[model samples]
Target chain A: MAALNIKKGSSSHSAYDLRDFHSQAERSHTLALIVDNEAGVLARVIGLFSGRGYNIDSLTVAETDHKGHRSRITIVTRGTEAVIEQIKAQLGRIVPVHEVHDLTVESAAVERELALFKVVGGGDKRVEALRLADIFRANVVDSTLESFVFEITGTSEKIDAFAELMRPLGLADVARTGVAALSRGA
Target chain B: MSRTMTGAKMVVQALKDQGVEVVFGYPGGAVLPIYDEIFQQNDIRHVLVRHEQAAVHMAEGYARSTGKPGVVLVTSGPGATNAVTGMVDALMDSIPIVVFTGQVPTFMIGTDGFQEADTVGITRPCTKHNWLAKDTDRLAGIIHEAFHVATSGRPGPVLIDIPKDVQFATGTYTEPRQARVDHYKPRLKGDIEAITRLVELMESAERPIFYTGGGVINSGPGASQLLRELVDATGFPITSTLMGLGAYPASGKSWLGMLGMHGLYEANLAMHGCDLMIAIGARFDDRITGRVSDFSPDSTKAQIDIDASSINKIVHVDLPILGDVGHVLEDLLMIWKSRGRKTNRAALAGWWKQIDAWKEVKCLSYAPSETVIKPQYALERLEALTKGRDRYVTTEVGQHQMWAAQFLGFEAPNRWMTSGGLGTMGYGFPASIGVQIAHPESLVINIAGEASFLMNMQEIGTAMQFRAPVKQFILNNERLGMVRQWQDLLHGGRYSQSWSESLPDFVKLAEAFGAKGIQCSDPAQLDDAIMEMIEYDGPVIFDCLVEKHENCFPMIPSGKPHNEMLLAADAEAFKSGAALV
Candidate 1:
């Protein structure tokens, strides 16, 4: 009930209001969802977003509580403040969704992505790649004379930077697990 | 111990337990078992429709008229796909309808077997909720759940796709009370603190308006009664969305007519200028709030809706009470009365004076001709003749629909049914039949345009077969009147495909279906012709020829704000390059 208190002239106004309408720019937010792990539940969630034309930049879902029959879905989507609020409101209306928490809005939340970089080269390029991997804390999960597959785990931004640095040197292939997010709390 | 029965028998048993008296449906390959069960049972009457689409529309009409979840049964594939439009229409309007669609046998599904369809997949987005029963044991439970989902909180259409094998296989019949559907619970009561804030706002505002929608009707008859009581107690000027008509008695002193795109001039002006706007059960759709940024700019708005997503979906409100309309209105009345029923009468009087000035514009005025009957004049005559009878009016989409909304005055909820949300073209004919079936002795009329009526004209056969006695009052303008009007205004009058050329002789068409047909063109004979259509004991089709070029005015053109309305008097000015802004 306390959260229901109306904020006087809150910065987040309805999209219909002309005063602060254009002031808010669109930004990406990651949301963690706990829902019933049942048939068509995932489809219903996906249908809601797709049917409404809302963009989903990244999405990862897995069964989190097998005993409780609950699955966790992490979705990264971009929208204006008003649009994001509407998305959350709509998601909450879906019957199977037990909880929806925006990790982006949470004070202490961690967002990490695992990526495998297959760098294929020899001599100077291989040595340089190995030295860069050492600095980035990327372990060589798979190694061959011609190719070295580096297993890296970090924030998406860090992984993007590492990939960008490895591109010119010897980056052959890239596989990434889209952002898996959770809040930092007991 | 639960009794064992085939799934087909369970479907019928479940429907009987749900208190369904009649079902509108069509037969197909996958549904033969259910149809056979229906044939054996005397408890539920099944009305076979000519097409699957009309069956859904009829169910919608039945639902709207009786305030019950209308039941529909159609087969797999094309039958299910054909029902998509009507389901979407019901979804948009919040009409409670439970559609049972037959699917291919469990093993044949996804193999593209005969009459196979992904009905659940296709309709997932259109329905409020849907289920695909893969097992026979779940069929009875799913049907019960479908009824629950369709009739609860914010009522809407729900579908249960039962495969042929499931229908044929034996299952334990689960009674309605035994069904365990604990996941989908919608909130029915309003927040007490929010109600307090709303009462505070209502008492303090100078120019207050109650802007209600179809939610008031969908909530129940008691909700409409409470709305009337609230309006009477506060002495506030009230307006409504197109779908919200009949929720408040039109003859009531506080009524300001329907407000929106084609709403009255005074109503739109009042909406734009009001200080306090109370939106009950009405979503702020694009049509209602034209140019959202400029919508109700000065109002401190409060919205009472059963659906949480509807609050702040289009226009943000100062107070958002998420609850059923009846529940919220009951609390509102109690709180207001406890507060000594306080209202600022002086300010309300001043507000009424301003509204009277706007009313002087006579936004609905049209040139009445003695030769060809004006569409508005025809509706006025129809309204005059059918005023006091037990009448239910359904309408097709077009200029005729707007004219009916303007000319007809509804005194009660559920008496006026139309395609408001999706604006389905051919909804009225089958809907009229459905209403007639629900209320056999009542005078049911489908006020239709020449073009929209043709969309589902084949339903004339269904009416004839059932002896529905539903009247089809067509305003034969020989054009898609609304589209033609838009072309005249916005598209430089190119007149593309709006004309209804090569149309059949409706009189002959009526006779071919074994129904009476009356065509009235002369203005002098209009009233008598309408009376003849009314007086006829059997189904009648009255094709009343009207002025083709007449436009539905007092229109807020798409994307324009409510205040920037185009009045009928200003038609010439707009055509002659006057400043529309």
Candidate 2:
């Protein structure tokens, strides 16, 4: 939660400053949810965000339990502290949701995303693309006479940095999976 | 050994086991099997409504009036779509209701067969929980679970989309006790330490106030009695939200009246000035909070609710106790009594004195009219005539609803019903009928505005057929009064399409439906007209023509704080949009 900085002489109730109530500093939070692995469960989770006007930057979900019938969804969203708290509470209200863990606040969590970059060029640009991939420890998954497909796995920020560098080296297209996060401790 | 039965029979049996005595529903092609099952059973009486929306509203009335879950059975596609508004209303107001929609056969569900609809998909966000019954073996258990989910925690509407094929298929019947409902269990009792802390706050607080809401009513009659006891022990002033009006007696000495937008002057002022605000069972809705930035900026706030999510969702509180309102109040009282029950009584006397001065302002006062009746005056007369009777009142949204909340004095809980959260216009009449059906000997009235009443005027026929003598007291102003009033104050009197043009003659409309009708326009004839409508043995639509230009006042206009109320006397003071801003 962010601190409320009280500005002097601006409010009648000097003890409590509320002028910036709605303008609290926005920060991104990663929430990991365990839910029933039933039909329309994902839609229910996503609909809550869209319906309540909460912003979802990225979402990834997959069935984690085969016998028990449960799925894990990791969602990265941005909101003020109050709004984030409300989002988590609202998500918990949905009947099928078993648990909601705010990995960002709960503890230091590992965040990873997988991305693929396809660079197509004839000579110098193609060599530069391969050189950058090699330097970043990205594997060249495919290659042709004019193009190379580089696969990389890292944090979202690292992936963004890789894509930014790949643009000058004739990056033709890019595809990235959303973030999947987990808490550090048991 | 469990006996097998058709899913339709199981649906009816499941409802009976849940102690559902009545169901408000409408029938169509896909629901025929269930309708046939309903027809063969006398244990569950079904009141057929003209529209699916009305069915849901009636169920809301039934649920809210009695502390039991209302049941509804509607066909798929159009039927399910039409019931969306009422479901949303129930969800917002925290009314417990289980809606069963008859879907197309499981095989032809997505193929868009006749009367097919994605009831589960469409209603998922609006309902507390929803399911599409793919197997007959799970139908009874799902129905039982639907009732459980709707009635537990923060009570809300739930839905089950049962396919026609499943209704026809045979499955083993599951008893209510056999249903696996342990997956979702709501906490019923508050933490003992937190309850003790609240008791301590009550012990030392001078300017303490109890802000209660619908959760008290939903917790059942025991909660309301416990609340009265708690208030008595603490000697704290109490105010309630619109949905929570009758939870505490309006005639009580410490009652501050209903608080919020359109709330009494003293109540809102007390809320704004209180040193300690203890919110019980009520979510601090925006309508009650006014400008959140300025809402009770000085008070040390504490909230007690069954839903943990409602605790800090809006205005943050210093104390948050999560549990059922009844259970918490009982524990709180027990702790306070055991701790020798102390309070700053001398300070509370001063607080009451200050409140009396605010009450002298009479925020509900309106200018007397000799020719045309005033809406507030009509409600006052209605209250005067029916104050001591076994009365149940429901109201359509807008000016008339606010006036009813102001004028009528309720001494008990579950006696007043309205669309407080959704503010649906067509809610009252159907709800009144539902109440009348549940309590046949009681006097049930629907306080309505003409425009709003006309939204579901077809329910009059349902009333006639069912012999549920509900009084339709329409304060006819020949205008969308609330809308017209807002336009006058905020839009420079640009009336737009706020007029109720070319309305039907209400007396004749009632006559057409084979029910009694009465019309009164003059202020002198109001009491007699209301008496006539009340004394009548059947349904009566009393069209009381009121002053067309009157506005609901003591209004905390959208962005203003509780202190900046626009009273009736100040109606002329703020005329333009700039003044409103």
lDDT of model 1, residue B93: 96
Give the distance in Å from residue A109's predicted Cα in candidate 2 to where it truly belongs.
1.2
lDDT of 1 by residue, A76-176 (tens): 99988667777877887676787777777644788999999999999999999999999999999999998899999999899999999899888999999
Expressed as tens digits, the lDDT of each residue in B1-581 for candidate 2 is 79799999999999999999998999988888999999898999999899999999999998888888889999999999999999999999999999999999888978979888788888998799999999999999999888899999899999999989999999999888999798788778887876787787888887999999999999999999999988977889999999999899999878989999999999999999998999998898999999998998888887888887787778887766778999999999999999998888899899889999999998888898888898888988899999999999999999899999999999999999999999999999999998888899999999999999999999988999999999999999999988998898888889999999999999999999999989999899888888999899999999999999999989998888999989988888788545656
* TM-score of candidate 1 versus the correct structure, residues matched by position: 0.96
DockQ, every prediction:
0.34, 0.30
State the lDDT of candidate 1 residue by residue for B1-581, as single tens digits: 88889988999999999999999999899999999999997999888898888999999999999999999999999999999999999999999999999999888889999888889889988898888888878888888888888888789999999999899999788888889677677778887878988888888789999999999999999999999999988999999998999999999999999999999999999999999999998999998999998998999888998886797778877678878899989999999999888888899899999999999999999889999999999999999999999999999998999999999999999999999999999999999999999999999999998888899998988998898999999999999889899888877777899999998899999999999999999999999999999999999989999998999988998888999999987777776563343
Distance from true position, residue A75, model 2, in Å?
0.6
The lDDT of model 2 is 0.89
Considering every candidate listed, which one attains the maximal TM-score?
1
